[model samples]
Target chain A: MSENLIPLEQLQKTCLYDSHVALGAKMSPFAGFMMPIQYDSITVEHNAVRQKVGMFDVSHMGEIFVKGPEAEAFINHIFTNDIRGYEPGKVLYGMMCYPDGGTVDDLLVYREYLANHFLLVVNAANIDKDFDWIQEHAKGFDCKLDNASPRIGQIALQGPEAEKTIIEVLGYKEAADLGFYTFCDVEYNGERLILSRTGYTGEDGFELYTTNENIVEIWDKFLKAGVQPCGLGCRDTLRFEAGLPLYGDELSPEISPVMAGLGMFCKYEKDFIGKETLLDQKAGNLEKKLVGIEIEDKAIPRAGYPVETPEGEEVGVVTTGYHSISLDKSICFALVKKEYSALDTPLCIRIRKKVFPGKVVKKRFYQTNYKK
Target chain B: MSKILDELKYSESHEWVKVEGNIAYVGVTDFAQKEMGDITYVDMPEEGDDVLAGEEFGALESVKASSELISPVSGTVVLVNAELEDAPEKVNEDAYGAWIIKVEMSMPSELDKLMDAAAYKKMIGE
Candidate 1:
């Protein structure tokens, strides 16, 4: 009927495309970018980074700067986390929710300078929505918000050797004392950069933020210094093994953070948008509960697949699914009926045309490495 | 990788079966496991399960994906690899050594429908 191939729009390239291609990486589409899924093999790359060290291109994440006389109050009113209580150089993980209590995006709020400004790091896919949301809510406040994503370059040095790699690269003795979730200004090649002791992978790591002009030099320097070049495939497996949720699969517009097992981020004491609906749901009106299921048989649980009770009644759907390299099982996270949220409950997933039996396990299939 | 001993038969899906008298031994090809990444779980039919030629009899779970195991010939399952229950990675480590199940072939001549190692290799673009 149509001669046109429904031509796909050109994809935006990252700064590391050539580098990844040279390493014989398998590239795949992710968040609108052609990203490397694996270099040699997913398992080899995953174990290499976990046992040693690795680096990830994290420039895709969105960063915003909020500054002004009313920055503190404005941020406190918007974020679910208590921004008023955070100290300078501290980062707090939280979410921005809609008025109806649905999560817009989970973000990390970094208190930069004393009460004057702060930085917010958000997921890559939600950058536009996050920026627009902040602007729409800033009409009555005296705060100024700026989308600094394009200008900023980010890299994550992760694994057991993360601290040593970052300290050596930046040549900062004070960086050794940096605590988890804390950031500090560092001088790298005469350029001042913000280095935070935080990362998405379940490893001891640091996320470095600097100008785009200096990022290529930094990436090259890290690779030369033996920070193994890692790809997004390993990143996904590492985070999944650590039981962290990906935004598109775990955090969706229709799903609430509470239903995703992140209710601790929601605060009733704070008078913010989405409070009333969340409060009503918290009062026992919630319908579905997120549960983690591990397939007892060999069948894999995949996203969008139907999950049902042993008796064949549809209970819910799989949100995220994968085989766990660490646990040696096919694991999945599903939002099932509240009554079926019990641990160790037998369940079945309809994959293709066959029914595979599974059982609910702990939300975290693997132990997290975050320092308390 | 085991010698795809010429006596055995293969399927396009990468399964290999060796028939001796009325019994057969089944295992996946080296290419199958390597392409599937790390094997986390292997579901095998029980000792008394019935299998039909071209019908799926079991499944294999790999990191980030899952695959089905189809029968090469109609038979009754006589033995299964119980070791896979604890160490499924063995399949990835050595696919030929980790034979999934053994069966008593109903139609021994059905093996003629399968290809040899050379033919199977060509189909997968080896």
Candidate 2:
């Protein structure tokens, strides 16, 4: 069967799916679910989050809970980050790697306020794979793992005015007290809710994780408050412009963290899966480096396009590219050979039959507004 | 629902052709542009490049997807719309107004093979 002919019954729906349809959003398939691609123009929705506030129905994300006395040790064993001695309410971003130095998934590890407990928020597309990978490593550990994806729903309120919206619009006074990368569990409408000061967009924002039953009410509340509802369209451009990596594109089984320029997240002092290989790559010549390429032309470089030297020698491929709505320049994240990954190095991108001249530059095309 | 102009002829691939004497003005229809959203780039052939009926001559790229611009008539490209280089969104603003290329027809008979606005409307289930 053709990939586009996947039966409508085969796709899944979030708790707020009806709300999205009612808003006249353009629906498209994403991660085996019928997701909203856009409501208004992507550029319009993008500017809303950058300047004021916008909300997203990110209920498609996966959540897993780890409990028991050995939870911390279990996490550190599979994860690349050194999460030791971290205080409760802290959320750290890292990845799980295979024994061969391949990435399983990049996720956020939240240290729950409860003792010996943690919450793992993973990408929507990798939910099943990530759950199975974590279970496989849970062989002899004294930790209990639970995939809580089906029961959970998430909403991200993002922008400079996010906190104000939560405080004034939603009447959540405690939201103003949360710091970046910190979360607090509170009760809302007689139900349990977890509010975290974390977001995929580089903007300052809050992610509200609650029961599937309660999320519908929260989404409707935001709608009543007149907050712009953002779809996955702008969500991607925002994160890409902020230099954040998407799992399948930037980091995959073949594209290791070392090659993706994410060595900072992998601590050499820690003993974890794929640490030795990452250490070797750190001390040696990496096969490829993820760098930013900017073209003077309006032609956009997309994924799978070839990156070449000025003399027309193939160097690498673009993982993600866009005619940056914020910067008004055509920029892309390309995985080029290590020799050609330096700043101001001249390169060319083969977009279709034509080649556009460009140069390697910093990957952060748009500066993040995260609260430090 | 996409607007279908009464006079322009359309190809199965959604390109519309407006003929004046030996010259043919070619561009994507309103339906095509509406589906493509905001067009960021238009890749077109140089002036004087020959184009054949039902053959690809250029492409239109949006943020999420790319669509090929198929020619509906056989001709030599007389002019390429240079305005789209900076304002590709003009295609989305007015698909009929943003003519991507103009071709001096070498085989005017190919124009008869294209569907009139009524047939194209029925083809798109209007």
Candidate 3:
């Protein structure tokens, strides 16, 4: 049967399901998995990461492995980022796009311990579609592709104190020395685990990739140590505050990385899928671009709200928005007409029956505190 | 489990009306506020605006989404809860006490169409 026909009640659950329930988490279905939306509260969970340390069960994220002598070439053919000289244990954040430059999914490609073997972490919602796309394009690549999503479990330990917490709680002291965007394999309970200094919250953190049983053990250790168990609700707000792009919201099939102000990740030197169209968009007059808007009123600007010019011309729509928990301002990321996306451009957000005045500003609402 | 006042009339939309002769006080029910979670803003109609029965008068915004506030009786808005503009959390704290608006009933008989507290409880599966 097709994926869509699957019933909502039959949604998958991560290995940490019982832990979340025991902690009084509000469970909701997201990306085909029954995930925790909030544990104590969104505000509390969000502040925990911003102030101290928190862990998120990111097990629902899919992991696909590609291995062969031609793995790097095959990855370069599908990915926008240039990974030709990437050393083992390096991680590159990039997108896989359709031939027409539309996004398939924004993902992280991790060079594994073994040479010529790489792991791709993709959004859970796009697992089947992305795997199918990868297989369809791998016909002539002389590489093997394996969907290892179900077998892999992931957790992100995030915040300023994440390094200390990981060392004290999980007994993974080597995590402290791992460079940003880099991963290393460490033995845990007689099994190898991948620990990477990467996170979506733009904080100093590390993500752990392991088996379900090991992940459960790690979660128990964190729980025993009083590390905050964050849910998807705060995960979004934290990532939003850090100006990270969510796949569906910021980079969709219609919204390319370039249009989303993520052109840096799209290396033009590499000949990949949609490279021609991306180069054309970079050189030519683009129609729309992503920008940040700050409203003067306390009234929040939410997703799908219409963005208009002072003269009432519809220019864009909000993809994600919130009365930011940390900043305490009503801000949003909007895809607006190219001409109207410049900083300090006065705009109006049509929310409900009234139009509130706003100004286009830097997309990064809050400064990120990543340990370089 | 939210408290339902027996004296108040309820709308299917989860608004409560405390009628006093021809004038009625309108507010979202406790159950509504509980479901909304962390009320951030309450958009209310200005005084003297006509609010038709069973029509959207304004909206109540929570942290996650916005919910439309439907008027249970046809009336002209006489007073809005101005405090809600700055302190919307009052609705979440005390949904029954934080009345949203006061309306002069144009069709007093519209109250007949509303459910009593007992009916409202049953409707909510309480």
Candidate 4:
């Protein structure tokens, strides 16, 4: 009964609202937008992406453009990842952080076709906040920042057969040759679209960004070609199964990328926001760390559930958990005390009134099938 | 539209109860299963555990969120559908057919306070 009490009138609808309604999708308010939670079933859509091909309406994700002579310097100052040596068509996954190392948002930085032109794809909920934060920091830099979230629409074609679907359905044959973490700008039917070989799902996939009208055309084309239309429900499940971190769940203002075990994305050689704190944590001064907890019981360990020791001492709290659809096991990510984060460390998760015994395991319950 | 049995009693919280003599069977309504999307797990109370009217006895988990299973009548749990422990999707398949618990009703009079199928249909804006 504890649902969001926000009025439906206040929510914004995407350009594909009519399409989703025509497909009999279940619409729900998410991140200030009325998004499709499911069209058929979460399991069915999830399996489609895992086994064959599926497309998701990801237009709610924010797209910010940074361009100028100081663009790379400005991005490197805010982003944790090193972007100095990235080619024009490269994409890097990293996070923007506060001075204390807490994450502002985890994003994908796409180096555009034009020199010194970079595109930052951020979470839907953090669009406005991230834009304001970036604008505030750009005062010192000479980069021109543009918040293009409302002007663009995105679709993710994901699965083992994603490349084939893109070629056969959208007629974008060049996508078949794109390398991992690379992108290209193509003009189709007089419309410019950015196709990137990067996805949140651990599958061989591509994300297409274009104008709203072109997105609608592409969506219709995919639907006609029999590609499954996925929703936010399976999107979370797919990313979770692949051990990818969700912004509000696994990464947050209180949780650092280092604490979340994403230290590799943070290059210590560059001095970015939260560099000092992250460097100190890398030297083994952190208190809590994220770890995977797998429960033997069928009862799921949900978010905010207390993680405890066998004798009832509270150790941490679950950030995200589920009875994994693919793995068929109750698994979760918890930010536990650093000492208890080691593999094989026994832990307990309190589900409702019962405390189920579990053990610390690798976060990846399902092995990724990303086409390297 | 979800199926609503005319002979069954329903709660505002979407629980359905079928009373027979002193025993009553409880399960989530079809409307609830549809609203919940897919049923991943059902947390059921142990046999012989006491439950009061309108109190939460267990929960039903879906992919998105968990919904508390509120008791429609006061009773002691006599049996639980153990099959749901492994095949929770059965509820999504047939909500009424997949009864969650059988209770030995301590007060069968509580059934009179619940709505009938007609009232439940109207309450859900059908």
TM-scores for candidates 1 onward, in order? 0.85, 0.97, 0.96, 0.97
lDDT of 1 by residue, A1-372 (tens): 111322335544567777778887777666666677777677777776678888888777899999998887787777877777767999988788887777899999989955688999998778989999998887889989999998888888888777777768757666678888999887666876888989887887888888876777888888889778778878887887676778777776667777777877777777777777777777767888788998865566888899998899999999878776566577888889888988999988988667889888887877766544
Q: How much DockQ does model 4 earn?
A: 0.75
Question: Cα lDDT for residue A145, model 2?
Answer: 94
Q: How would you encode candidate 4's per-residue C-alpha lDDT over A1-372 as one tens digit per residue?
A: 112666789887788989999999999988888999999999999999999999999999999999999999999999999999878999999999999999999999999889999999999889989999999988889899999999899999999999999889878889978998999999867988999999988888999999989999999999999999999999999999889999888899999999999999999897899999999998999999999999998888999999999999999999999989899899999999999999999999999989999999998878988767
Model 4 Cα displacement at B69 (Å)? Answer: 0.9
Clash pairs detected, candidate 3: none
Task: Output the number of the TM-score-best candidate.
Answer: 2
Clashing residue pairs in candidate 4 are: none
Candidate 3: C-alpha lDDT: 0.91
Most accurate candidate by DockQ: 4
Worst 10 contiguous positions by lDDT, candidate 4 chain A: A1-10
User: Model 1, stretches more than 4 Å misplaced?
Assistant: A1-9, A48-51, A69-74, A140-145, A293-312, A321-323, A327-331, A342-362, B1-9, B19-24, B105-119
What is the Å distance of residue A294 in model 1 from its true position?
5.4
Compared with the true structure, what per-residue lDDT tens digits does model 3 show for residues A196-249? Answer: 999999688999999989999999998889999999988999999889999889
Candidate 4 per-residue lDDT, tens place, B5-118, comes to 999999999999988899999999999999998899999999999999999999999977899999999999999999999899999999999999999999889999999999
How far out, in Å, is residue A80 in model 4? 0.3
- Grade the docking of candidate 4: medium
lDDT of 3 by residue, B1-126 (tens): 988999999999999999999999999999999888788888888899999999999999876678999999999999999999999999989999999999999999999999999999999997
Per-residue error at A285 for model 2, in Å? 4.1
How far off is residue B50 in model 2, in Å? 1.9
